[model samples]
Target: MSRLEVVCPAGTPAALEAAVAAGADSVYFGFRDGTNARNFPGLNFSREEAEEAIAHCHRHGVRAMVAVNSYPQAGRAELWQRAVADAHALGADAVILADLGLARWARSRFPHLRLHLSVQASAANPEAIAYWTERAGIRRVVLPRLFSMEDIRTLVPALPVESEVFVFGGLCVMAEGRCMLSSYVTGRSPNLDGVCSPAEWVRYGREGPMLTVRLGDVLIDRIPPGDKAGYPTLCKGCYRVRGRAMRPFEEPASLDLLSRLPELMAVGVRAIKIEGRQRGRAYVERVVRAVRGAAEQAARGRPLDAPDLRTLMEGGRATEGALARGWR
Candidate 1:
């Protein structure tokens, strides 16, 4: 069996270099614009930076994948179109895309450039995956974080294209590309603006010994003095229902699937992706190194002991997410 390829994140030039040095087979990043998800201030690459980063990845024998995964706004399709062209010009190994029209445009403009369906596309079922592969010639699809191991084991053999799964990093409770909770609070859509709970709208305050977190005037959560405060994203926030405060959607936790590396490899997963483009170089390096070590061990048929990444987890908590049984 082939060793599973490790795909890592790169929000900045430093993060890209760190991922390369840390044993990532590929690094995915986006331009500093709304054309890709994880669009945030001081994150992603400029055109010149992307060119240089791609060259650096090539020098280190690592594939550089560009993300043009956001839906184009009406009368502003040119921005996304330009991103697709730029990725090909920069010699990107593949362009990860979500928008249907943009994918068609990419195929028409650069037929030889490899195309990958971003998880934002949310092509979970075989028919949906086949549509993208057959119609747009997408070579691979990043499976959403919603599937269990059994679902993946069955889905992979049925699909005609290669499969990539998120094995570690932040967990999203909602379906990728389809979430609207952030827009409801911050008026920024992740699908179009590539931002969810954008930092600009986030506010923090203190009331005596309690810390209050808000997203656009709407209180997300309140932490007691001794408790840790998490980023105030609408979905991950605790809410009051039936006169009691609880997290109805999901908690602010990271996903770490190191223990399941062997099972993922056994299911014929081609690549394992680690999510966190908005994080720093230290995050990219540590995650890539850990995942790389686990992948190697899985390939050697060794016992897959879960790595200790508690400090690296969001709010210092980790979960198997939907990959485990009874997630729903």
Candidate 2:
């Protein structure tokens, strides 16, 4: 079996170093602006930082991919274009993109820079994947977090491009780049604005032995005493639906597929991506090391032995995340 490339996240320059040192094959991150999805405060790399990051990755013989993945808003298309230009100028190994127009522009201008279809494009099937691959000359496509093992087995072989799947980190309840629940609560779009439940509007406080969390005016979650409270994301929030209190979307568990690395490899997956560009360097180091070790073992057809990473996961819990079955 071909070895599965362990593509890791690089939220900051420090995180980039952590990932490369931890044996990542490639480290992907976004710009510190509206041009990429994880455009939160204090996260992502500035142009200067990105240059250093690419240089550091190359020194370690690791690929550095820049995420210019956010959709271009009306009249602000140039902003996205400039991000692509900057990525090429800074010597990124590949540009991960979602918008068709931006992809076409990148291919036209920088003919040699590799192109990857971001998960934000939500291309799960063969036709959609083929359309983007043919149109943008895409080298790889990050599959949406909606494919089952059966689905992946059939789809990856038929596609003309290499396939990447999320193995660890956050699991979106909705199809990528299409969630409106966060936008409903906070008038901002994660796909367009690049901030999901933007940190500015998230509020947390103690209320009668319960921790109450609110995104804008909507109270998304109320954690009882002694319960581990998670970050306030509107979709993963506990809501009162049908007169019953339940997490209408998904629970506060992260996607953990360390045990299924061989299954992913057997399914003809070319790469496995770890999410959480908003995570820190320590997170990058631990995850990359653990995954790198496991991926190496899987490639050699050896029994994979890795430490339990539950404490590092979201809400101290983890799920297989649609790889074994459907998310519902």
Candidate 3:
């Protein structure tokens, strides 16, 4: 099996330093504006910060990727255009993108710059991936959460570009770049505004013994005092159906694929991505360091005796998610 690249997330400068020090093969981040999907308060980089980030990563012999992944509003293409240009100018190893217009623009503007198809594009299969690769000159693709280990084993050999899969952190239930659930209540789209539950619109209050979280006026989740409040986003929210309360999308558990590292290498994945740009340096350090060692173990064809890292995840629980299909 080939050595799998350990791609990690870096939301801030401190986290970027931590990830690079922890042995990340690559560190991905976004601009402070709505150009990237993880556009929460105090996350992402300014142009000056991006310059320093790329330089620091390059010093450690690690690649740096900039995410300009969110869809641009119809008339406002310049902001996204500038982000793509700056990523290339700052010597990013790749610029991750979703919008067709933005992809087209990036390729035409910088012919030699490497382009990565974002998970937001949801280009899972060969046919969909072919369209982006042909039209926008995509060199690598971040696969969505829809594929299982079996599906990935079957799919990677047929794709035209390098395959990158999410190996750890948060999970998304909806098809990327298509969800409107957040906008229905907060009037801010993650696809456009780049925040799922905008922090300004998020409210936390007590409903007797239960703690209630709402995005604007729409209630997202109710937490019994000691429980973890998870993400305060709609994807993991529990609601009543026919008087029975349940989480219709997915249960409150973070994605943990550490044990499957050897399986991923056997399937020929070029890179493994970690999905937590909204997290802090401690989380980045712990997950990246653990995953780096696990990848090395897997590369040697040795069975992985890895930590589950459940304490660092949302809800302090872990699941393989769709990797095992109907998992309990």
Q: Could you give candidate 3's per-residue lDDT for residues 34-116 as a string of tens digits?
A: 99999988899999999999999999999999999999998898999999999999999999999899999889989999999
lDDT of each residue in 1-328, candidate 1, tens digit only: 8889999999999999999999999999999999999999999999999999999999999999999999999999999999999999999999999989999999999999999999999997999998999999999999999998889889987888889999888888999998988888778988979999999998899888889998889989888887765567787898999999999988888888888888888888899999999999998898899999999999999886645888988888888999867887
Q: Tell me the lDDT of candidate 2.
A: 0.89
- Cα lDDT of model 2 by residue, 1-328, tens digit: 8789999998888888989989999999988889999988899988999999999889889999999998999999999999999999998999999999999999999999899999999997899998988878999999999888888889988889999999999988789987877777787777878878888999888889899998877888999988887677877888888999999888888998888889889978999999989999999899999999999999998898988898988899999878756564
Candidate-wise lDDT, in order: 0.91, 0.89, 0.90
Q: In candidate 2, which residue pairs clash? A: none
Task: After the best TM-score superposition of candidate 3, give how far the Cα of residue 33 lies from its true spot, in angstroms.
Answer: 0.7
Q: After superposition, how far is residue 253 of candidate 1 from its true place, in Å?
A: 0.7
lDDT of 1 at 210: 86
Which candidate wins on TM-score?
A: 1
- What does the lDDT come to for candidate 3? 0.90
- Highest lDDT scorer: 1
Taking the candidates one at a time, how many backbone clashes does each contain? 0, 0, 0
TM-score of each: 0.98, 0.97, 0.97
Better of 1 and 3 by lDDT: 1
Model 1 pairs whose backbones collide: none
